[model samples]
Target: MQNDTPLYQLDPTNRFTHRTQDYDAYRPTYPSAAIDAILEDITPQTVADIGAGTGISSRLLADRNLKVWAVEPNAAMRATGSKQPNITAWEGTAEQTGLADNSMDLVTSFQAFHWFKHNDALPELQRILKPNGRLAVVWNNRDRTDEFTKRYGQVLQSVSSKPVGLGRLSDATPIRQTNPYFTNLREISIPHQQALTLEALIGLANSRSYTPQQGAAKDLLHHRLAELHRAFANNAGIAYLQYQANIFLADPA
Candidate 1:
């Protein structure tokens, strides 16, 4: 999906280190079913995860016995992935992956494709993927229809509406239209939930690329979060945060 305003332009060097701790703490791991679905028709002997932050998705693929190359441009993220023996973390971007041509059986991006310069990255992906290889993109987005999720989303918008940019729903159709490499693009909507205390919710928000870390904005964020906690707290004092995992899968034509 094409957005008039970009969400966040991260500095490649500082991006991973600055957010590493929070990212490792708060980022949701992909469901095993999603991974299985992605690998169903195509048996990927070797896979490359572009923008593989902290190896969340890479680890999932690796668990399926796929040799995973966790390709991340950010140094700190690569460092984090290096600790995992299953994944070989490489420092690379989607546009210029250092891996040899036609070496990858699958090229995947999880919540990271939006960061890529598509014009440049598309050809790179095409080059790396073997014939009829799969290209899958997955995003876990808030299920704003639920009351708790709606309130949490409102708090996020109140904090930084500018950075959130246009809604993901609006962009999906256009993305399908513009990208010609994928012939049979299909979406799999998976229902998911995260049980969180107020503190955990705040940590999740803080891990986002657009969230402000300090000063008046940070104070405001905390204040709003407090209100959100008070408003959404349940009998057990924990909120059930609902999410929808929207996965788009296609083959490189």
Candidate 2:
């Protein structure tokens, strides 16, 4: 997917270092069904969670009592994730995870795969993973078909400092096929819902690296989000943000 599309010129590793608080607080969590699909037919005892920002995906595997090495290049993000139970956080990038060769049963990247240098990362993932190991990539795309979500997306688009195509929305199948390190790619989509209060919705928008962190644009983004929340939220003042959790699972080549 990245072959046909250009990515952001800025270093991906440093993008979220400043957004760590919102990222850990407001980003949507993966569904249990998605976890079931990732671990299906194989019981992974050891996992290397690449780009494991704040150990979001790492905690899922760890909760299953699996040993997880959450590899993240951002020191701030890694430090926060290191506090979680059943996880060993490593300060490393997807292209250069400091893990041994053929040592992991599974390697996963959630909401962070788009940042990887695809060519370099694929081989490293293969090197660290066992012969039958699986590499699962995941992204949660909001249901833009919904009117509120559509308007919400519009607000983000208005203030976004970078282009949207550079990130998670891109398809991973073509990207995987071009690389020899991973093959037999399979895709799964699970419905997910996030009930967010107004502040959380704003926090979620602020968590994105592409969105403006400070300026009049940031204020405008927040104002519009609040107005939309007023118009769309339920009686409980909670907005149900719908998402389709897209998952791509592939085996080592």
Candidate 3:
């Protein structure tokens, strides 16, 4: 069944304002294989990670010894991300990253591209990227193939008054259509998983802005999640949220 109710309006300036702590704590990182594939042929000296919530993607790029500009609009998220070494956490959005024209050799956004207003952001991203720059958009899509994962989806959907469109990676039609500024689209998927206890799973849910985090809804969500965990947790009393790190790479046209 489709949820036709609109999700609560997001704050234009601080979409993840209240969810930063949970986001930093529970959001899974991109797979190393995905990272390796993104950096496969090119040696980039400078990279810009737009919508870099809590620096998860920025730190990954920094680990490769590249200078990274972790551009994020949310104050709380940017502050937490700034503490990481080799990262210059800038208070900026994908549409207005405060960087010189043609300043970056590569531009990346992990689990962030969908949030962007494609028309405005594409030009801004193109402005900052060098002639040879590549744009990579990535997301860790939850694998709902197994019973546990399907049940977990039910937990979130039960609490979500608005439909959560989490399957964006599988359909590249919109991303491909919106941005004529890019060409030679390439896609890759890397299998991944994250182990979580029941509490952590709740934390993961809280990290999503669309989910209800207060009132009876919050109570109901957590209760169902605990029940789900009890029914499906493995021998070690842990649940594995499987994912496929989907990456879409293209050259600036």
Best by lDDT, which number? 2
Residue 108 CA displacement from its true place in model 1, Å: 0.9
> Could you give the candidate ranking by lDDT, starting with the highest?
2, 3, 1
Candidate 1 lDDT by residue in tens digits, 66-175: 88999987877776633556689888888899989889889998987766766677788878998878888888878889998888877777777445443743234424
Better of 2 and 3 by lDDT: 2
lDDT for 253 in candidate 1 is 68
Q: Give the 10-residue window scoring lowest on summed lDDT in candidate 3.
A: 3-12
lDDT of 3 by residue, 70-180 (tens): 998888888764365679988888888989999999999898776676667888898999989999889888888977877888788878896455554355554577566
Sort by TM-score, best first: 2, 3, 1
Q: List runs of model 3 lying over 4 Å from the truth.
A: 1-9, 164-171, 178-180
User: TM-score: which candidate is best?
Assistant: 2
In the range 1-253, model 2's lDDT, one tens digit per residue, is 3234444345777888899999989999989999999999999999999989898889988989999999988888987743656799888888899899999999999987877777788889999999988989999888888888788888888777664454346469545566778888878999888999999999999888878878898898899899999999999999888889999999998
lDDT of 3 at 31: 82
- Best of the two (1, 3) by lDDT: 3
Alpha-carbon TM-score of each model against the true structure: 0.89, 0.93, 0.92
- For model 1, where is the 10-residue window of minimal lDDT? 165-174
Measured by TM-score, how close is model 3 to the native structure? 0.92
Clashing pairs in 2: 1-175
In candidate 1 the C-alpha lDDT for residue 190 amounts to 85
